[model samples]
Target: MKRIFFTLIVSVSLLFLTSSAESIDNLYLIGVVKKISHNKVTVNVKSNVCRGKKDFNISPHIKIKLEEGDFIRFQINSSTCKEKNLKILKIMKIHKPRMEK
Candidate 1:
């Protein structure tokens, strides 16, 4: 039936759209909490290339309490090379305690 064929086509199209999205990950050396607005954030992130695709929202895996100096690894799902297109999936902060040499 035509109805059955149409339903199959719609399902296949949805699957392809979801699977084609890109993925990316990057390390962010956290600085001051610049601001928090909506689902977005602005922080001074330090990395080899200071500017890259990054997500503003902190991931759920990140502990509720964090400090300014913590270094965090951020994972995002997005289209490559677009700033606003990235979505954060996971966040792991690095704890570095100074060692006396």
Candidate 2:
């Protein structure tokens, strides 16, 4: 009886863990450079973050280089928020790198 119960618990736990892991899929977003002032910025992303809202303050080290009216495609690999503010874990600069002679 003990062996059977232990096996059942383990199996159930495994199932839950697998299901949760599967649900945690990576999310992506494409943003347009709305404005860049000082070291801070705001972007307009479609299909991501706050119902595709405009003028969302970006977190630091997001690897974005964009000018006003320039579009930038980016994504947040992982994030954590405090008081509804997001902190980017992994980011990439979608713009092409400048050539060096």
Q: Rate the local accuracy (lDDT) of all candidates.
A: 0.53, 0.55
Pairs of residues at least 3 apart in sequence or in different chains that clash in candidate 2: none
Instruction: Indicate which candidate wins on TM-score.
Output: 2
Q: Residue 1: error of model 1 in Å?
A: 21
lDDT of 1 by residue, 1-101 (tens): 99999999999998888776543354334333445555665655555444532446766564445444444555555433245644455665555445579
Predicted candidate 2 versus true structure: per-residue lDDT over 8-44, tens digit per residue:
9999999999998877333456665666776555666
Stretches of candidate 2 off by over 4 Å are 1-26, 48-53, 57-59, 77-83, 87-101
Q: What's the residue-level lDDT of 89 in candidate 1? A: 56
Ten contiguous residues with the weakest lDDT in model 2: 79-88
